[model samples]
Target: MPELNGILVHPDCRHFRGDIPCRPNKENGYLCADCPVYAPVQERILLIKLGAIGDVIRTTPLLRRLRREYPAAKITWLTLTPAILPADAVDEILKLDLASTLHLQAREFDLLFNLDKDKEACALHDTIRAKQKFGYTLHPEYGVAWPGNDLANHKFLTGVFDQLSLQNQKPYPQEIFELCGYEFQGEEYVFDTHQDKGYSWNALPIGKPRVGLNTGCGDRWTTRLWSDEKWISLIEQLQQAGYAPVLLGGAAEDERNLRLNAATGATYLGHFPLEQFINLLYQMDVIVTQVTMAMHISIALQKPTVLMNNIFNAYEFDLYGRGQIVQPDRQCVCFYRGTCKLGTSCMEDLPADKVFRAVQASVNA
Candidate 1:
């Protein structure tokens, strides 16, 4: 066999937890003896993250990797507001809300990871007791319990695990599969009623290859959109090519989604539940969106997606992959804050022809 090099350490050379003396350190430039994550095997785990439906969805893969590495461990997630709740690995969701008494009630966990930037998240993480505590390495003023708000100048999935171990961490991740052992089977996320509103997915139809369309982007970033005529022209082409387009958005998009659906006679499903919306997306042929979380969902599901962004640089692709970026590639306009400097003219420039070919090829592929 080839050289299988390793190291030996003193019994006193333990980590912060003084329990997990070491595992073969595969991160940074250091060995296990130098690592700070020295907790022994944990029985329960917790992960906290908030906002942006797409980001929450994309983070799902971390759970899968964790489960594969450690099966049979009980895992939980700490979530905020309306994020894509991971049903597969998480045994529970620690809701960060006004009515939640978890932190105040002195809930003890083996480990809890927070992955948000807001200061309130830091306070809660510090209070939650565990054998080992860790979070995204942030400023000292934030007052978290452990080491690492570790994500920094990283790309794509790197922003999750390795970045959390290196760069600037906002908080620790909330993935439940980090424990060493378990057997679980379920969908990526489960959509259910929100606080007894009597909502259900039973009424809506579940179709194959579900495709979601983020027709309305934030008003400030109008330069990132494809024009009305361009959208209509492209959807028409999709219909002609034997695919149906399902228009999606939030309550803020009612007027636009309604008008566009009327104008082109497309299927308009606006401002639905994020989980229900994701269920619909999982049933589509493709998702065509702006630089929104919906696009992230498509990436998480490994579904074909087309993102209409303003640029083709590595940064934009970091948020939205190049494979799903809109046609013609680069944007002539530079305005990206609240509204386009050149009005909606930048979006108007992209004709349906360019996107149509890409759509057909992806659909066929």
Candidate 2:
């Protein structure tokens, strides 16, 4: 890491304007570390974290921590196109569209944090050229080494993140407590961006302690998913039991979402903007999702959540939090495959009544 005026500027860092030549002199354009701007960067921070909805939800706590870490900075988030719709945590949401954004000039940002490990995402961080960059080192051992689909991969990532916090002198649980500085607001957050795939503003939360649900299935991947029929059955039970259901997912998941909505007479705000989805989730009492991101979002929301995971491959830390987990009665038979040899008999083993009881217990509790 090369230092300029106390700022660590890795020579690999890309910050200068292509044709506009400016000397790398510390006096004129000093580095991030030594500059007066670093501490104030939380106010003008840029974050690029894109993946499943749960991942985005999980990252919200980082924003809270960052704000507490740097109280005076503005936070501008770079969000995936439609995902940018309703993010209440972000001060401003920038679309990742290269065509439109390429014409826009880069501005001076105090820090850039890339939560996702996508190369394209890394490139975006390189472009912003924030005074500071925080992310997985892109190291081979940066996370768990996975030869096959396994829950340990998620566990490994959690461990890697913990180690990263320690390496940075930032502890884990305390960091979480510090970031979750604000008390949980009962209001549901909503979307601001209106791109096609983006969520609509009309999508709002209903009921106090509102709960969000991601009841979708997985086919291409080995990650577990509860059957739609099971989730629908649970939803109907909740409806008769006086609970309003809120379904969230991308537009592609809307068909499944509609199926759930039609069956239960609950609210089906089709895949709104990503921001909107999260904002709406904030108002939920809890979120119950398949093994994917449901529980992840709940953790971020500081609300209780329940996720159904394949017992063998669940992320340990996530399962430890305000989220409760239910798993297959048996070890994963199919593991990671195009299809399960047992026709996913292992997952089918979780009777809906047991899940319904769990839901009732959660809702009442």
Candidate 3:
């Protein structure tokens, strides 16, 4: 037989692209360094973030920094929701589908960053075709593991235990940046959407310092929701205090919004799709809500925000000095558990008066 050609030996290898020879790998398997042909690939970057709308939005700040660092690199982002990303920021957008997954596995990339911690995401990071892998990954037996970097390890350690997380002083974005060896310089959120749909405000008189109360905390985190009575009390108090209280929520919150509106005579702005809801959010002078998508939107719009957070790590939020974080007077016993073990939720213990005061400060500022 003719001499075995290393270049064509593993043509189907995930890293086998064009004339580029794979790196020498005797121990791990593919001995690319001994390949006959060698071709260097252009810088290709991959980012996988997946779902949870709020998280997808908060991660946009990384795009700016990444572009700055890799100006000529072709950036490809994989996300479940693509509507929220800036139109001109990314070079390619890949949805979380079979075709996209196959394409990613087959393609060669210089760097890959998987920000999500889900098993699926971690597995993808561990198996993808990239010279370097950053962010979280799955160990075959021990569950999710970081890239063995000090900063990333610290971030991962904090996530595993509540005690460590409570001591975290860096903001969420900064933590991610540091994981990639980049220093955070106060980057803000970027939310560029296709504003094809329009929402009519019904000519409601424009009120200065318009205050919006976001009543829903999403289905997964019921521990963040304030009591119905607390909401009603805050709405009534805001109105009496001379502020326009607009009730905001999705279909899940319709009944609650209706009840609150009827009881307090507050303006109930019916929920629209994500894009339309964001449009309405821009009209508000300030937003009051349990840490949710609404709070993220308010921060994206640079609107003053009064954020109520209890179970989640407070350090995760970076409101850019435009908001105040309100918590229950008592230390949360159910921190990050999503469910409250106590008979009454810590959120319920958060008095309406306290929320009202926070709202007032935000509205006036």
Candidate 4:
């Protein structure tokens, strides 16, 4: 306990901040001694999961279990995409940068979890001061990333070897929960929908079920892309089926979306910023997308989703009983390869009719 102006300060309180007056004091004008909302943090836990936005979103299920197991713990999460994390769930959401690294190195945590296998994340895990550490860390002797504990061996193995990844049936949430020594019970993703921002899309037609078509699979994985022709076909089919098909993507898919809109006359609202993009996705009754950020967002929003898969394992995703995973009829020769080795992508085998049926099923369900 620290003395502030001769009054004992509850530094262990989750809302206590040394730099400024805590929220309770500012809002209610109550001293720490008489605060009703005071919550003493029993443990300090650090979670390092810096990566692609989808991975960050999917990792949120662990927070549910962590809260259940350690209700009085103050959780700090370090990530590159801090904006995507639910603000209410995490006590501290620090963007992974030089300043964050320095802050983390200085602070001591009761428990630390480094979920990313990236060298930078592992290296930080190795140097960070923590009483106990779980998940992956940079090996002190070999200068390579390795599991910090035995429980992370399955996740570590699946990450490094494509063969093991293909054979593994454990979903991502289960794997991460096991790494932290907990059983996964179908925890839902914690997401910030940005509904507070008050974004609206008047251009979207009413009276029909809005079907969002997320067209891009990102440049890294060209093998995951469905052909423009396929998208056009799907859009036409959706419109004919009395569904209002909406084109969805960022700047990367703008041109394709424009082409689809011109060809099929589907609703093509131009791409907006990330926050607004999330809000736009929220309007959809059901979303049809590749295994990208939109897919994870749809899952988080609890929207009926139809996920298209080609390269990654279908079993890795836990849709929380709200969606279905549709894969190519032909087996993907490239398990995790960005470029297809088979001259043409196997996504061709997954017909537009199959995807339309999936969308129809998801909407009807």
Highest TM-score: give the candidate number.
Answer: 4
Better of 2 and 4 by lDDT: 4
Better of 1 and 2 by TM-score: 1
| Candidate ranking (TM-score, best to worst) | 4, 3, 1, 2
**Model 2, 99: alpha-carbon shift in Å?**
5.7
lDDT of 1 at 157: 38
Over 4 Å off, model 4: none
lDDT of 3 by residue, 134-232 (tens): 888887678855553455686787778778998888888898888767899988777753345555777444754678889998888788888789998
The per-model lDDT (C-alpha) reads: 0.55, 0.55, 0.79, 0.92
Which candidate should be chosen as best, given lDDT against the real structure? 4
- Show the colliding residue pairs in model 4: none
Instruction: Return the clash pairs for model 3, or none.
Output: 20-39, 22-32, 23-33, 24-33
User: Against the hidden reference, what TM-scores do the models get?
Assistant: 0.64, 0.56, 0.83, 0.97
- How many angstroms is residue 80 displaced in model 2 relative to the true structure, after the best TM-score fit? 1.6
Worst 10 residues of 1 by lDDT: 171-180
In model 2, the worst 10-residue window by lDDT is 144-153
Q: Which stretches of candidate 2 lie over 4 Å from their true place?
A: 1-44, 82-88, 99-108, 126-128, 136-214, 218-223, 228-287, 292-303, 311-313, 316-323, 333-338
| Candidate 1 wrong stretches, greater than 4 Å | 1-42, 98-105, 141-212, 269-271, 311-323, 327-336, 341-345
Model 1 lDDT per residue over 124-163, tens place: 6666676765554344674532234322223223433532
